[model samples]
Target: MTATDPRLLPFSAVLSSLENEGAYAVMAAAAAVESATGKPVIHLEIGQPAFPTPAPVADAAIAAIAAGKTKYSSPRGVAPLRAAIASLANRHRGLAVTPQHVVVGSGAKPGLFLATLALVRGPHDHLLIPDPGFPTYRAMVAVANGTAVPVPLRPDMRSFDMPALEAAVTHRTRLVVLNSPGNPTGGVVPLEHLRRIAQLAVEHDFWVVSDEIYSQLCYEDTYTSIASPPGMAVRTVVVDGFSKSYCMTGWRLGWAIMPPPLAERVELLLVHSVGCTATFTQEAGIAALAGGGEVEMLRREYRKRRDIVVKGLNAIPGVRCDRPQGAFCAFADVRSFGRSSKEIADVLLQDGLVAVLPGTDFGEQGEGFIRLSYVSEEEEQREGLRRIAATLGRLRPVKAVA
Candidate 1:
């Protein structure tokens, strides 16, 4: 083998299909620019929580390690943690989820991958994922060697454009991936529309994978679960976790709950993929799930930060942001600005030392948008938004050509 050829290790064919993800690139740029400028990077890029993980959850993990629960348990995860996830959903969502229906793993991310692996019947069948939704949705579909059909949403109104979505579905459709308190756009589908999608699922005989990871991170409205919809429970696979709610990202704990039948298949796949999450982490999950006030403190703080970021973002010129009803993000339209979303992001990084993800990172339709996360301290958010205003305010708005 040639010297240069040896430098590259052989990997899955999927490696070639993996395009450079834009949001990650944006974060890299933010890091490089801030390092060069010696500026404290006001990170509004990633969706991680602003507050520390609840103390009890951290304590439980530490305690588990102390007790020598570090060994791998089961592919289906520790029974206590899996049961805790089911109980939490049933109590909070008012949907009866049983331990037999739950399968835990490293995090919502891996659980999601397992769901995709278990759901897609063949390479030819397509999965419907929302446009401008979580980039991971599309990426996961590719990793599973399946086609991803993007169902576009109207960012201006922050809801699904029903007719467009309806047209995208074909006889080859096998799964529909829906995310509430959605990423990038922060669009939450109304109950009525959710039912309509469920109805369509019944008509098409397709399985539904609803991502409720942001279930707890909402404002102005109560969180909804697709499984709560009558008759949909059997066809829907609900995925949610302790990361966003309990601020337990590093803990790497999450669960996938499906109707009992699919849960079995999911467990088989999970076994081959991760064997199991650490035993101690599962114990910590139990602590997070049982009723507590620590999680509420984080919710309260995120709500405040959302307001802090939203108000400041709205005051910026050539940029208009919709009030997000849920999630710690504001979807701002920068179409009025003379620059494209990428250009605007670059200028902000160079001028204000602020990191914001371009709308285009989520979907092509997001070209005029920028996702501004409020997952930072209040004072930092205020300063970042002010810098954004100062930088964007100087640019003249350009009129679109006829």
Candidate 2:
């Protein structure tokens, strides 16, 4: 009866389907624990690099701001930045792309969201995403009003179960999202798997959205893109950014490379939404692309951290961790302790004063596991591992539910 009554306002049903990234929630809880106890907390939750932004990138942004480059630019991004992105793609991914094929966004997330929006039409359309993958993949599908079909990863947690993926594809499938050197698991898709996925996309006429934000951090001999397979270039959308490798998470610059026509539409979505990424950040992106030495050094450091985490986790009584081929997170199996991922993560944060993410935060497949980021200092990682082992040891194992 009142103007402000709940009955008068209807919210989109999609609101209930959305979920927050678990890292932030765990981060806050860890902060609260530290505050209450007046103790320092070891951080292994958030995924950003511990290194500062490379000096060249910081200087470029400052110079751009001083030169009065703060005004609005094309929603597609500044010409130089776009060109640099295209060049990076061509050299790294073996794709022939021009500036017209690039559409920049505030971060890799926007590019991923826009790709979903462009492909998924309605509930009738389905998007296949990895289970225990980046949470945003499902969130984007929900926002686009498309059905999300989750394909389980293989038991190794390194790649998709091909049989499961093939069976999941239906005529309604419009998009399939791939994150090589994926989040949470740190699994890198093998080239053979990429070829198979490419074949499936071509047969089903579904577009592939490859999230390669961590491509530069790969510990393997070589990184391959789904776009590199024949017939995939036209159908694959490569979403990447300067956040991870460049240590420029706050810069908020990312881009998608697609066919020229789709790039145009994605750019239009950009125009109506966030308008354009910050102009000075684009300048910094150009410098990041040009400076590869620091990127390699960071990759080497991450490899060392990964070794420390995986080895230490294995030393724990009931924990098992595989060496991550890429990315900076170690997905450790803690099921032997007979606790849910959330329960283990909470104990780690509240008792051990160490921050880590519950595996369920990624998806149902992440249950019985915990994700620990190795982006902190090497000593901090060791200390966090010690705390985790001690905290987990205190809890007696309960019978696992069937």
Candidate 3:
């Protein structure tokens, strides 16, 4: 506990470096607003699914607990859960992902972090992420001591800019993070773009870490995976989980499929970071994958909700929005409503009593936009839209006082 002994210091370098990340800032603000107002905030910021975990999944967890299956399991994951994930992969993506290649952790984020650690090598190694991308990717890269290089996707919300991605590659670029049915904007990466990115990764000898947690939640087209593309398996590491797909966030269970060579290191990293996932939780995840219809039903509802939000947002004057193809978010360009996305978010929070994630929270390009999660009840969706329209009007170019 000496001052010279850095481990005993009051400050932590890792913790200090992550202080500027904005995901938690939005959460904290929402928490304070909810507590202070005592009126429920129309929460559009979090990426959580509003649907309850399926009865079957919940039942399985209960049954496992009743049967006293709470003991610690292997760091890699329980045999049956990983096997079920592999089976699901084979059936869905035509990839023969074996359980041996799988490693499970608390959630998809942790698995992603572990993948970053295992795949990112040495100082100044770089990972590519989409502009206005998942904020966690940048945080994970920083935590791994790897540089994050932005690969700006098309602003039209159509596909990844292949040239930008290809041009960003270098020897130090060890990982390329891909998200389809992306978070901030629900744009699905077209198969063609994925193929080009995969080809570039192959040519550059870099790995692709595909976060496919929202694979089944697409609206217009079926989900595709880099691993399923020809000649991609050896260089692609798939990170997925039951949280979004099964509404099983509290389960703290997610799994990763890595190239066999990297599987051991990822598992070891999981061991040191989290030791092992709860055995009962993995058991529940097995039940989720073994039966997947509830997720399909949820997807139908989300498609409906997305329609509601897109139509509503577009109706609001000066708030242009695109209909997202996948994921349950509507990224609306609200620059006309306010000077900044954060300002629009603040106005909504105060005037409309709704809180959405400002686009700036995602990245620099997100300044004039805001991400709205349409995971509320149908009635809430309609009412919130009404409120947003009225609220934005009130906040519009304030030349006069009411």
lDDT tens digits by residue: candidate 1, 224-265: 787787678888888888888887878888888888887888
Per-residue lDDT for 1-402 in model 3, tens only?
667897777665656656455655776787888899898877777767777888888899899999999888898888888888888888877898888988888999887898888777656788888888888888888888888888776876656677787788887888889888788888898888888887887788888888888888899887788888777999888888887878887788888888877899888787888899988888889888878789778889999889889998888778888899887888888776447888888888777888788898878878888888898788888888887888888766533211
What is the C-alpha lDDT profile of model 2 across 1-402, one tens digit per residue? 998999977778898899778988888888899989999999999987779999999999999999999999989999999999999999988888999999999989989999789888899998999999999999999999999999999987888999999999989999899998999899999888888999999988989999999988899848888888889989999999988999988889999999999988888899999998889989999999998999889899999989989999988877888888998999998898887899899889888999999999999999999999999889999999999989988885554322
Model 2 steric clash total: 0
TM-score result, candidate 2: 0.97
Clashing pairs in 3: none
Per-candidate TM-score against the hidden true structure: 0.94, 0.97, 0.93
Provide the global lDDT of candidate 1 against the true structure. Answer: 0.81
lDDT of 1 at 309: 73
Span of ten consecutive residues with least summed lDDT in model 2: 393-402
The true-versus-predicted C-alpha distance at residue 20 of model 2, in Å, is 1.2
Q: Which should have the higher TM-score, number 2 or number 3?
A: 2
Report the poorest 10 consecutive residues by lDDT, candidate 3: 393-402
Once fitted onto the true fold, the runs of candidate 3 whose alpha carbons sit more than 4 angstroms away are 1-10, 20-23, 397-402
True lDDT of residue 381, candidate 1 = 80
State candidate 1's TM-score: 0.94
